[model samples]
Target chain A: MTQRPSDTQPQGEGNGSKVNRRGFLKTVAATAGVSCLPILQTDANAFSLDAFLQKHFYEMSKEELERVIERLENEYKKTYNKKEFRVGVDPPLAGVRFAYALNLAKCIGCRRCAKACVKENNQHRGSEERGDQIEYIRVLEMKKGSLDLEKSNHYYDHPVPDKDSYYMPVQCHHCNAAPCTKVCPVEATWQEADGIVVVDYNWCIGCRYCEAACPYWARRFNFSKPRIPDEEVNTNTHYLGNRPREKGVMEKCTFCIQRTRKGLNPACLEICPTGSRKFGNILDPQSEIRYIIENKRVFILKEELGTDPSFYYFFD
Target chain B: MGPALYFLVSAGLVFASGPGRGEVKTVERRSVLEDQHGYYPCSDCHADQETNPKPRFLQEEHDSPLEWEDEAGNTHLVEFGEKLAIGDLLGHGGQTGNRRRNLVKVGARLDVAQYMEEQGLSESDSVYVLTHGGANLWCLDCHNADDRDYLRKLNGEKLSFDDSEYLCGQCHGPIFIDWEHGVHGRTNGYWNRELDQKDVTRRLLCIQCHIPHAPRFRGVVPEAKPVPRLDPVSEPTAESHGHERHRGEYDRLGPHPWVETASTGHAEEPAHDGEKH
Candidate 1:
């Protein structure tokens, strides 16, 4: 094979054919400078299945997870020439803190937060009568007197208030005593060490038991194999978020744990033009979510139900 | 320079014959462009699509064509198809041929896995095996571009779809509709102004919607497709098919029953029950 400029070198486009497959492989190896493993397992140099089996987001040792992030950053640098792209293998902060506050006064029913949530959590896609793909947050418009969920249907043809109306967006509460997790037969759905509720798309049996068990009707089953045409499909997947799910398994709000744990604000918070939503580490007193819980009057839906949901609502 | 350069692009998708091989296989690739994105030759962007369609300077020279104006506006052409890449299209970046390539915009139909569940193909031995096997089917098969007449779409009356619209529409009609009508599609702008006119906003091309490096959504994480920035001025607009269709009311006046807060609270008030707007 002729000596050729590497793809990284940015030669004029036609000058690229000089490199062959073997040369390309060699270039990649030299660029990475990572040594090959001596054996499949047992050897100190080899990758062990143990690392894969126990690699939960919260359960990782600091050194181990940091190493993983380093490996990721290196790989990304090699691919896109971003010399310093670091990935988070574990949550930056900790404890089983529960905090979410929604200001009823601010929410306009634009559903931008819902769109952001669907993208952020990699929520499975579905269709609504609006003839648009939908998932997760369903912004319901309610009249002042009517508390009935059925009457407060979210479907809107025009913009804001038709008259004296208010919008309520609902999603998974990630309850501390989650009834859905308890009812899961295959153990596909479970609460994480950080108290975030999650459903493993690969493991879910799609039994819909979790859907039935939830009093809030939070869980939704995949009706069709999620046929997300490539663009809309979320690739930054967790076992719980974004990866395509099997049909029939129950799914609900994951509290945007994928984003929250990464020190990124929840998609809903970013997209809320009205700034109706707030998210932060519940354990930390400085977090807005915590401040709202302490300073303002807060209420959890069906607090008497004892599910101990992480979500809280505020009126003032 | 004429249509001779057309076949060169398709020829590149063909498997190469190394030193030991002789005859290049002659399976003409059908154009998926009209049925989908556009029947575009690869050389239009890539510098290497058809480097040598004919023998030039002792090597096989591809038939990539270049449009250059000579003295009296009479044009002279250069064809080097296989050797073409993205750079060659600097001035005439993409003026090769007439192949309307629209981004096949598809809205969330059934989550593929969800749809399979509705079909009862559980992860049992029989079902799982079929799924695994079915995944191997080449995307180009069902996404057949050969059918010239396959381009029929419900072009909603508003803004006529440009090349981007037609390309994605051929294989994905439903998504095309949503995109054109604002569900699957995207635009850029704030409270007001027309697009690409006074308050211009470029439409999210194919690349925008599907970011290759950071693909927002995809399954299995195969080599992700390149996505461009598709941040629209506003969300795709809703298709207003002259109603009296789904829920009657072509137009009317009353209290907007659509207002959730008003209707539900005052059940006694008939005016609140969507009888108004």
Candidate 2:
């Protein structure tokens, strides 16, 4: 029966200050209110109060989501100096769970997918001044004989399929039991019914806890305001996917949720010259992913962690 | 009222019976022959001339190799002009001496193995090999001798250029099967079959990616490296992160040491014990 120091302290007498629960709560409320005052005041402009108080994606009604999309579209149009901007909110289709299979043998260490991802996702294009570049995919050039990730080079600059090396492009695996989602303090990130793990950009508090928790180095933080050029900004955006993210929010691969939800192949898959990247609905019996899993030498990145990633790497 | 009801029922039945679930609908694809610029419609060149179905070394348009020198003072050679289905040798048999001599010529380049061995270069040093089935095939083997435009199957069925997958599938059965299932090759457009309203889902034809004469994918300069992050995070030291978890895992889970054999779809045993776990 040890009394804690806080319980033993005389509330009104300590240091000539009367600090009780009520006082502490009042202080907290005032701080929160003051912090949110800017967002509250900027209702008419880009930072709308409604946007700040926007509910989680799943909780939002159809009408509410529509309104949010309209607001975002307007905001993006002004910010990116575009005539028209679309914010798609397509829900996951029935009996469809998206999965990706990359042919490791076919991947020639070409970063076409990475570049295409940046362009399609509206990520910050780093300049000399800003010094912040965000890429969703990292193609690791590993020696043919080794599986040591430490020995793998992320920044190999040469004509690829380099003598004794093989390329392995790693991205957000969108795990069934995602560590990133579990550690999300604000419940901003979660796995969709279609197995695509997404983050609500507006709801994220930039804690970076999810980033640290991710084993695949999937989560990327916007350390500064994303500096996308007006011309380069991708107008087609999704709320829980690749809508141009604000500063401090965590962003990763959403399986191109904006595109995938509409039954279109992801930008990376489309741009791959080598036909290395494969994507399909795993639930469907006729899907290429199922074929690869069944026939090819398929393996997940970190099977021991029990992440059960929808992404599979295979060899022909 | 009876006649009107009967007519409506008949119309509904007709619409319902248009295409059954199992009915095979031919996907309308752009003609591969028409897509080939400058060198399609083999009949254009062969129609007026007499057909010589002899297997001989190409001495004309198809034989000219485009040669150039790079900034590094190294010579680079590229086979230019129309790629015929013909190989170095005409057919199998009666060319044993020639085959033994030309065996050193892997792909388009002659004496490559000898050159590599003399230079003490590894197999990877060579950029690419450009032969189809080790020059074992003749033009008439796949290409129809009767009709220059149509490809010939083993059963002598004439196939259009667009249906070259069927021709390729004759020899590369496993890969063809994988391609048909959308596993081996690139698939563009809609991933969902049901929602493919515009018929955007297009599996690339064999000839689209691979030249009939040289099927091996050539290595090329990759895209630019990602801009390095400004504030570099300290990497985890090798000692702290020992390879205990991945020590034996590489052998079992790393790229399998299976040799690709065309005859049987299954992977053959590992070439040597060094590659095995």
Candidate 3:
């Protein structure tokens, strides 16, 4: 570990110790007060100074990114005792903008999608210290006649699809005019070419600005170190999605970038029993999402805000 | 790739060892009792009986107990016992058994006149109607069934279980049209056809999701409510909705914390003081 610079310095080696030491101490105090480097350094991880100074995802050079990825992989192996954990930086797919449409009539509120998301994203399981598990998707049970966000009940434990109710699962909408990205002071988060808004976990300064800016309450802040069991950790993680996040960073859904970039379905879509959830490249006119958008009365959550969210919902 | 190639080579080696001698020498013949045989070339089983025998119902020795299904009473009930009298069998109103139960029995040959008289149905009206419950049409309506328990399609064409869609489409025209567009039933293949060829074979048939006898989807057990992130340090709330982990004061609906930071005069330093690991 690199020792943090302190106010004290050793006596000069070549004599005239008092004069030289006084000058050195004065200069150090002057720099410390103006720079705040000492205060920021204290916030850095004690184990590795290099990790603390690592650049954000976009700012890093190719070689630097590779170094970071290698370090992360090694760190995962040591922490989890699993040599097979792989962390890949998959580039965004070209000529493809992902979109999702969920049918309100077909969803039965089984929450199988939510369950699969927790497992796929490797979210923290509930512990004695943390009673609730972290789930990316929230299925809101709303009354049949209205679509009131405030009146919706996500904690409804009753036998679902309760004759008069309908379920709407909400997550990160990956808005085109994302307010979260605009509010991020450090440019730690940004929208990719494929319409996915991703976060550079390491670079996020725990500012929680993105959390406040998101209209759907999509972003989540890690107030404590995320504790995941060794067996439950999903090794097929991407640089932008489902990566092991540290305490104080913000994390939200990324449309399962690791799987989607490889032409695989998101875990939630694959697990849905009713086939209510639909996901596909929005660029392709023949895609199911496009068909639904054209044929069905598709609507976004807060259309008035003009966020241009990729996620859509329609009734039968 | 190497392992797959090796396995293919090994499989070829095993087959190349030659077929068993006995299997090759044996004569290939369809079984007499096979369902598709349907008493074909009848002499094998009925060699003694003359070609033109007395009417089926006139023969006393071939008499079988008629079983009535009490469709109105309880369709799920299964009752099998006692011979029904001719009068009782012909009586329409007093028949206590479900009409949908045993439309066609294994060994019993229904007398058309008696069935019509018992159910008060005329020759112009068919006994079997098609729906989710029992089809009004009997086994003989769609199948040429014999006493030996063999069945064949009425037109002598083979019926495919996989292509039952056409058979069901005979009556359900609108629903079948909806199914063709992947609207009604579960579709199990790639939704994006530009990437992968449209494989209709992988799509689920109407029968796969809905049983013909009972077309309703079975109720599934709801997954446990998401244990929201409760304040681990605080006491548990008795109210179900109250346990929601309070997202700090600066969430979606709340104002951005820049104002408070300016007021507190600690804008230079990020305020992450209370976070615990």
- After best superposition, candidate 1 residue B186: deviation in angstroms? 24
A best-first ranking of the candidates according to their TM-score comes to 2, 3, 1
**Model 1 regions lying over 4 Å from their true place:** A1-92, A96-98, A127-134, B1-277
| Best-first order by lDDT | 2, 3, 1
Greater DockQ among 1 and 3 belongs to 3
Q: Each model's TM-score?
A: 0.40, 0.73, 0.62
Residue-level lDDT of model 3, residues B27-92, one tens digit each, is: 122221232223343345555654442212221232342222221242221112222333333334
Candidate 1 C-alpha lDDT tens digits along B2-85: 566767754543322111111111112122232223324333554333333221111123344334342235554322112222
TM-score of model 1 (CA atoms): 0.40
The weakest ten consecutive residues by lDDT in model 1 chain A span: A43-52
Candidate 3 scores a chain A TM-score of 0.86
Question: Top DockQ: which candidate number?
Answer: 2
Tens-place lDDT per residue, model 1, A1-316, is 6656673574443776676778888999986664434233653223434333535444568886566555544543443334444343344233435456787755656777777776665454544422224366666667766666656644455656334667777888889999998988877788876677787654566788888898776777766655454455444544455444445556777666555554445667665644467665565433455556776678887788899988887766
Model 3, B110: alpha-carbon shift in Å?
A: 19
Model 2 residue B220 lDDT score: 81
Greater DockQ among 1 and 2 belongs to: 2
